[model samples]
Structures are given as structure tokens and as C-alpha cells.
Target: MTAPLPPLVRLPLLALLIDAALVVLFVLIGRASHNEGLLGTLVTLWPFLAGLVGGWLMIRAWRAPFSIAWTGLAVWAATVVLGLLLRVASGQGVQLSFMIVTTIVLGVFLLGWRGVVLLVGRARVRRAALLATAKRMSTAG
Candidate 1:
């Protein structure tokens, strides 16, 4: 059997996959809302993907794959800003309202999962600590 991947490699790969999936979902939803067919949506996917890649590079996202402050917020902001800039540059219409909507939606999509993960991680740590304390008390008693 092949050896398992180290956390260093696996975590970054997982983070990249999750972030890319969120970006694609954001694009698909936006296009669907406007009744843009699948083919049309596919046509517009590149700009967002470009922004996502730009964000990943700017943040060096792999360094702290699970950090909301360092990774989530930075990535979300970069994705929206860079995506819109690219959209404008590519002759795609980007109205003020569209910008606002995209920002809010992508913010939720990208950061929501990170927030959940943070909460769960905290809970796990707390639980483990409590268990450790209980075990020590039981043993001492």
C-alpha cells in the first residue's frame, strides 16, 4: 500500500479544494439566479477562478490553511476584489449593486465554512481538556 500523505501536504490540498469548490458554487449560483444557462455560466467561470488563484498566491494560503483571519478573510476579499476587477477588465459588466451582492454572497460562501470549522475545533479542544481534567481527578480520587 502507498504511504499516507503528511498533514503538511494533505491540509493544503484540502484547503485548496474547498476554496475552489466554494468559488465555483458562488459562480454557479449567481449565474443560475439570472437564468444564465449552464453553458453561459461556464463561459464566465474563468474570472472568479482567476481571482481565487490570485488570492491563494497573495495569502500563501497553504501556510495557515485553517486560519479564518489569515486565510478566509484575506481570500474572500481578494476573490471579490480581484474577480470584479478582472470582470471589468474583460468587458464584463460589474455594476455597483452587483459588486455589493457578490461581496456579501462570496463572503458567506467562503468564510461560513471556516467559521464553522473554527467553532468545531474550539469545541473539540475544550472537550479534550475537560476529559483530561476528569481523568486526572478520577485517578487522584
Candidate 2:
């Protein structure tokens, strides 16, 4: 029987899945806005997907999957830059307006979740510290 992976190993996988899903959601929204059909979703999505995987590999995101600064920024950059470049190479449209929208939307979707996680983690730590301080004060009083 195979042993289950530890939390450290599992977390990166979860992060990658979340990132990929958000990228897909980005593509879906864009395609839907254009009145494009689901049949061409993969056709439209591959460059961005390729870029996302490349980003994860380039930054070794597995090392710090939840680090918004470390992992999220690199992933967002690679997804946008490479995705756009690949689209140009693949003879897809690369208009200024589209590029702007792509950059903004992908940035939000990719980094937004990580930002929330970071904030939540910070809040939890702060709450814990406050509780500890309160407990200490009560005990001393």
C-alpha cells in the first residue's frame, strides 16, 4: 500500500489545483463574454495553461505554494506574459484592450486568493497573540 503524502507535500498540490481552476475560470468568463462556445475552450486556454505550468516550475512553487509574494506574483506574471506571447505565436488575437483585460483579470484571479490566505493567516496569528496576552494578564491580576 502507498503511504499518503504529508501536509507539506499535499499543500502545494492543492495550491496548484486552485491556481489552475482560477485560470480556467478566467478563460471561461472571457470566452463567455465573447459568446464563444465551450468547444473552443481548450483551444483558447492552452497557452495560458502552458504558461501557468511553466511559472510553477520556474519558481519551484512547491517550495512555497502559499507565499503570495514568492509564488503568487511569479505565477501571475508567467501566466499573463507567456500566455500572451503564446497566443501571438498561435495566431490568436492580441489586441491592446484584450491584453489589458487579460493582465488585469489574471492578476486578480491568481494573486487575489493568495492575498486573502495571507491576510487570514495574519489575522489568526494576531488573534492568537491577543488571546495569549489576555490570558497572561488575567492570570497575573
- What value of lDDT does candidate 2 attain over all alpha carbons? 0.93
Task: Report the lDDT of model 1 for residue 52.
Answer: 86
Per-residue error for 82 in candidate 2, Å, reads 1.0
Evaluated with lDDT, which candidate comes out highest? 2
Candidate 2, residues 1-141: lDDT per residue as tens digits?
999999998999999999999999999988886766876788789999999999999999999998888799999999999999999999998999989999999999999999999999999999999999999999999
lDDT (C-alpha, whole model) for all candidates = 0.88, 0.93
Enumerate residue pairs that collide in model 2: none
TM-score of 2: 0.92
Off by over 4 Å in 2: none
Question: Residue 60, candidate 1: how far off, in angstroms?
Answer: 0.6
Error of 1 at 104 (Å): 0.5
Off by over 4 Å in 1: 1-4
Q: After superposition, how far is residue 58 of candidate 2 from its true place, in Å?
A: 0.9
**lDDT score, residue 141, model 2?**
97
Residue 131, model 1: lDDT of: 100
